[model samples]
Target: MLEEKFERLRNFLLAYFNQDMESPEGALQEYIEENSEGAISTTLAQINTFLHEDLTEQVKEQFIEDNCDLYFPALELTPVEWLKQVQAELKSTLG
Candidate 1:
């Protein structure tokens, strides 16, 4: 259940916009846990890694564009499409 709710979304959403999360990953997870009807799909262990990484200072958009390979597999869709997905997910979850 967590996997369905958190794992894929976590990878996508966290990596979706940027390696550097707008907030610490744990806080973001907790926000998801409290805010969305879906679920917190990531592990605190991984969030811990995010918290400690250099990504903490990276810009959300820059991180996404630069690491396109990490976030977008095969680069099938254009970056704009990927960004739309990113925006949609964030709006759905965080709005």
Candidate 2:
């Protein structure tokens, strides 16, 4: 299911951030390998589109509320704002 895959990808990316946000291509590669069911480029494109276009603001807010503990203390952004940054990073990595 796309919904489950998206959540799994989100969780993986967030956990990856908890470790290192400076580099995400590695995480993206790992996720691709984990779900090696289709073309890697297609998977990446789908995820990029989902992060950049599909999710609604309300959904993003709820995601933040659900994962408050994942916040980085050094960043003053609210959870939703931080999530936007993460989304940008993931999109960049996809490219």
Maximum-TM-score candidate? 2
Residue lDDT tens for model 2, 1-95: 44465665455545654455444445545655565444444545544565566667777556545533454455666655765655555455546
Q: Any runs in candidate 2 off by more than 4 Å, and if so which?
A: 1-6, 13-59, 71-74
Q: Relative to the unseen true structure, what is the C-alpha lDDT of residue 55 in candidate 1, on a scale of 0 to 100?
A: 46
What are the TM-scores, per candidate, against the unseen true structure? Answer: 0.29, 0.40
Model 1 regions lying over 4 Å from their true place: 1-64, 67-75
lDDT of 1 by residue, 2-55 (tens): 334334434554453354544333434555556434433233333334334454
Model 2 RMSD in angstroms: 5.7
By summed lDDT, the worst window of 10 consecutive residues in model 2 runs over 64-73
The CA lDDT of each predicted structure is 0.43, 0.53
- Model 2: how far residue 9 lies from native, Å: 5.0
